[model samples]
Target: YAMTAAHKTLPLGTYVRVHNLENNRSLVVRINDRGPFVRGRIIDLSYTGAKDIGIVGPGTARVEVVALGRRDTSAAGSATTYIQDDYYSGNFTFQVGAFLDRENAERQKRELAKKYKNAHITVYDRGDKIFYRVRVGRFTTLEEAVQQEEILIQDGFPDAILVAE
Candidate 1:
């Protein structure tokens, strides 16, 4: 699937939400190319796209995709202009763990905080399920986030992945 964005460039694996008209179901798909370009279409789905909307045999279906904004990649050290009321919010920060057990997550957060001063945990509730996330650092660029992920992996958190804010 492809996502429509104001900017011409889009990175691969960019997630887009696709909604099926028939079933009112939605699925997230990755964008890898230019676009659908049809008159009124928002996204172009592949032959296996039917499976996403829960109809494998049907060739085509009306669908809508809400394109989540792309990642900001402005270079570091660029002059940033802030309005009077605007504070420097800094960059995006995320943790490594999103566990179901809060105690386990807290334990991990404490252990990580000893090494990484910025380490913290957040709890999320989705339906009846609970999730605990452990994250560190406010990174201004994706490169910094990736570097931190590498350091975390080398420190034994091999399963760590970079997430956007």
Candidate 2:
């Protein structure tokens, strides 16, 4: 219920300042979930967040977003702490697709595996439903995954994107 938002590309847990260009109101929000997948949208704010910035009634507003580093999720309750975004070394992968059906995900994985090493599926349980995410290759750095993303795109997986696994 704290101010939180969703972004397609920002790393989860990153804090960002959302500035409403229409009303000149701004607020800080944490990136937690994964979308606003519409063609031209950027961020999806919580209901309270939208109301605070005076955009709830019209349902959409032009806003500028500024990343303000990442939140330290490890720390105890309510004591917010932020860490620099520069230092992160973790498992990264290239996600080719996500499917609601397990069989569809498996089919995609099999096809990917024929030409790519480490093609697999990871299940994301979203409480009421599930998603099987098809992914290929695993790397310890973002650069490695990004390089592979381009290859995957060229090879016909146009929606391939780098994801922190």
Candidate 3:
């Protein structure tokens, strides 16, 4: 995996440099998903990332993790204590709008994606069928999402609301 994988401790959107300690290879990845959930894995890398570090075939390797800088608005504490206290916070994102018609949802998503790097649509079962939700950006803290919600409101997506992802 080239993009960074999940770490139980690192907050989402954290910029980190993962080093393949045994081979001395390194690559930077943005933490976007939660995982490795398996014990002993510190960070997961996307296929491209693992390939870059020469670990694709092996599927896993020892890596030295170094935070480039946490994009996480909340960095609780040292690596150890941080993981413990970290449960206090949750990952959040702003939903600018949702539409029953996939076309409308896709239109909004395309429009927003053109203007915002993190803009995308999430489809979920709202009732008997599915609904498309146009969401933009991820934040480690609810406050950040709220702030973005206000901006989206000002930008005319008045329905924007903060939601946990």
Candidate 4:
């Protein structure tokens, strides 16, 4: 069975379980699409399923996933969200940019702040390498991120990629 946490139409053959490492609770789920692409996130459960597994806030989690067989429509407890195709409808605002140097990232952040309203640089140290990420806006969906990337690309920031925050 396929397991995923993103928004896509699911076929009739996927099963997943979210096992919380902290609490040792598990919730069986169906695979509807491909997601939970956020760094360090194992699975993305629906709101109800997340509650059942006891994850409340918005952040990464340590969880184990066990793939079962195909999904049975006649199953007892299945979680579903009626998210329409246009569910990500919103004004695009956020743009995330990756940089190899801290000084260059800071310079870009200052420049963007002069043009736009909100621009910030987040620095992350991965082993001996440091990554500086410049993000704009408080977007709600990947579509919004893609829209903002278009705008940034027009402004000469071509290598930006969308990331969930």
Candidate 5:
């Protein structure tokens, strides 16, 4: 219920100003999660935030989002300027495969868990269909995840790809 939002490219914890062009309404929101995975949508505002910006009734609206930087709690809650490089530093994992059948995904996860830590299945629902994605490992740094991606690819899962969790 907090005034948080989801954005595909913004770094988590970054603050942004969402301006609804239709109503000329605006609100400040924190990027606390990643999503709006639906194609063509750039941001996903929380219920309270969308209501504040007059976007709840219509569901979606043309909006302009401006990054307002991340809050620096150590410096008296001041905000630090946004940096492009900050996006790469976060939770990451390698997706070994995706399956339409949950059992298939589970089987892959079980096999991966034998040789890897954090092997699990993440479900993605796209309205018409659901996909079970098997992923392995958890790394805070992209470099570390990429290193494992190579190993996973070489081990057998050639299609394994690094994904930010």
Candidate 6:
């Protein structure tokens, strides 16, 4: 299937324009999966899209990507953003809450599910303990995240901190 590739960080359904710098070929693809988790890799091209860009044989090529926008298609699908193209502090997000307990993290995630887009819990190890962080929304520009962070703080997420993801 030559639909599209996965994005580890960007929200699914995001519109991304991938430009093959070598061939000067470009394609706009909608993200519908997750991947390219390996370091130094950004997006994984599908066989169809790969064929279009003439890179199926070479397997990999240097490319530049530009995020066009995103449309939420979750079960509660109603949120969207036309995120302007900004290069400053790319992919900044806000961590509204963090808990040492997974249950507490899940609880927050549920509460946010009703009110925010891309609300989810990301588990990670810090020092000797595991922390579950409840994050909300992925923004390309830091200013956008900061605006939401302030709203979250006013709404009682006092610990909301902006993170460059």
TM-scores of the models, in the given order?
0.48, 0.73, 0.44, 0.41, 0.53, 0.47
Backbone steric clashes in candidate 3, count: 8
Report the C-alpha displacement of residue 47, candidate 3, in angstroms. Answer: 50
C-alpha local distance difference test of each model? 0.60, 0.85, 0.72, 0.61, 0.83, 0.77
Residue pairs clashing in model 4 are none
- Tell me each candidate's RMSD, in Å, in order: 13.2, 3.7, 13.7, 12.7, 7.5, 11.3
By TM-score, the best candidate is 2
Index of the highest-lDDT prediction: 2
Give stretches of model 4 more than 4 Å off: 1-96
What's the true lDDT of residue 1 in model 4? Answer: 26
Please give the lDDT score at residue 50 for candidate 5. Answer: 93
Ranking by lDDT: 2, 5, 6, 3, 4, 1
Evaluate model 2: give its lDDT: 0.85
- Model 1 backbone overlap count: 4
Q: Write the per-residue lDDT of candidate 4 for residues 71-159, one digit (tens) a residue.
A: 44564666642222332543334445668988888888888888766688777777988888787766766565667767877987664
- Model 6: runs farther than 4 Å from truth? 71-165
Off by over 4 Å in 5: 77-165
Pairs that collide in candidate 6 are: none
User: Candidate 1 lDDT, tens digit per residue, 38-151?
Assistant: 334455655455566765566556777655533335635664322121112335565567799889998988887888858888777778998998887777676676678678
Instruction: Write the residue-wise lDDT of candidate 2 on 1-165 in tens digits.
Output: 679998866788889999999999999998998877664688999998999999899999999998888877798888777776752467877778999999999999999899998999989998999999998998887777778878887898766756664
Give candidate 5's error at residue 107 in angstroms.
9.5
Model 2 regions more than 4 Å off? 9-11, 21-23, 57-62, 70-81, 87-89
- Pairing residues by index, what is the TM-score of model 4? 0.41
lDDT string for model 6 (41-145, tens) is 788888888888877989889999888875444435455545543446688776777799899999989999898899888888868999998988888786788
